[model samples]
Target chain A: MKVSDGGTVLAADVFSSRCPSRSVLDHVTSKWAVLVLAALAVEPLRFSALRRRIDGVSEKMLAQTLRTLEADGFVDRVVTPTTPPQVTYSLTDLGRGLTGHLTGLLGFIQTRLPEIEAARST
Target chain B: MKVSDGGTVLAADVFSSRCPSRSVLDHVTSKWAVLVLAALAVEPLRFSALRRRIDGVSEKMLAQTLRTLEADGFVDRVVTPTTPPQVTYSLTDLGRGLTGHLTGLLGFIQTRLPEIEAARST
Candidate 1:
């Protein structure tokens, strides 16, 4: 348990089912969410560009993930009124804060892939 | 793409469906896996103690999560031939390395819960 600067009593025990942090954790660490965050860390990208960069994500899943991240204050969604209505997504300051942590985790796994694969074989 | 000291070529792009690192990332970040790793960070824990610490985890899920972590070389399971077959779970060196990154992420979420909640309401 921790007391926020705002004096709100905060309990972030992910072990506890009642913790609100668990939902945010789930959303941020979801399969597509991680990939999306990693992709956007480089720069803001349009919906089509994001979809292309993230390999196999379906449009529906990508849209949902962006919405979820946006709601969590980790992503910014900008809509422009063009002939086709351009939608671009980028990391919010909060989202940028999380990118390094996630990318570090992802990079570790990538670098250790050989070791992990060897373990899997045996 | 990066190459290990052992001269093994590594491709850890999680965006690619065929990447082995993707599976490792998924297992390590699974809901129970994160909580289990966080719990084990402080000290080794018996099966029952771990179950109790992680509030709502089912016996089956806990067992499965442990096995997955062990297979990934991130967790060590020690079994003792006791009256009830005492088993303790702890982080391996690899697991310990990841603990800081994960706990940092979790701690951030917990501390920022107030802000996240406010964002949700608006």
Candidate 2:
């Protein structure tokens, strides 16, 4: 099966290791990536703000996740050429499109936390 | 803000490092977990068939993922005590609910693969 993109792309199968979607999914579902996307869904934040929003994330890791998301078209990074050179990050249209699933999954897990914790202990 | 669940649950904030959802999200988004959930989203599969469907997953990792998912209540395990003792895995109702988001995310990525790849290359 083919997925037309300039008539050059094929339909992606997540189960197939050869599919590019597999790798893309990897980036989207990474621990830091998930958290970063969730953080941005509420509002645009500067680099430091994003770092603070997610617990246990290191400076280097947050930077790496942002760079990857920027490249993947899910994040928009803006640089202001000010005296301090301020930088901010927000979700791109593509990122916004993908964020619905993230939010949905998050809500599902959140509301069911009690059940999940109970399941774990048993 | 409060989210009542049995009058014992609290509202969850994913950005809060202390949220239980953080750890649950980690488990749900783990590379192997993502793949396993996607694979099982189709239908129940026996252990060997599931391993074959997901490329690059070893027996050990698959076992671990299944155990975790089972513990989390997103997956149900069925044992058929045949001569060979067959064990099958299927998504529980909870798993089914979460899978809609998974499939949604996967489709978004799959359909937009071209755009994503183009973004990455630039």
Each candidate structure's TM-score, on Cα atoms with residue i matched to residue i, is: 0.90, 0.91
Native contacts conserved, per model: 0.63, 0.79
What is the docking quality class of candidate 1?
medium
Task: Judge candidate 2 at residue A87 and give its lDDT.
Answer: 100
Q: What is the docking quality class of candidate 2?
A: medium
Model 2: lDDT of residue B64: 97
lDDT of 2 by residue, B5-115 (tens): 677857886767777777888888988898889889998999999999999889999999999899998999999999989999999988888778888888888888888
Off by over 4 Å in 1: A1-10, B1-10
Cand. 2 Cα-lDDT: 0.87
DockQ of 2: 0.64
CA shift at A68, candidate 2, in angstroms?
0.6
Report the lDDT tens digits of candidate 1 across residue range A4-71: 43677666677677788888888888878988999999999999999998878899999999999989
- When candidate 1 is compared with the true two-chain complex, its DockQ is 0.60
lDDT tens readout by residue for model 2, A12-121: 78777777788889999987998899889999999999888898899999999999899899999999999999999999998999998899989888887878777789
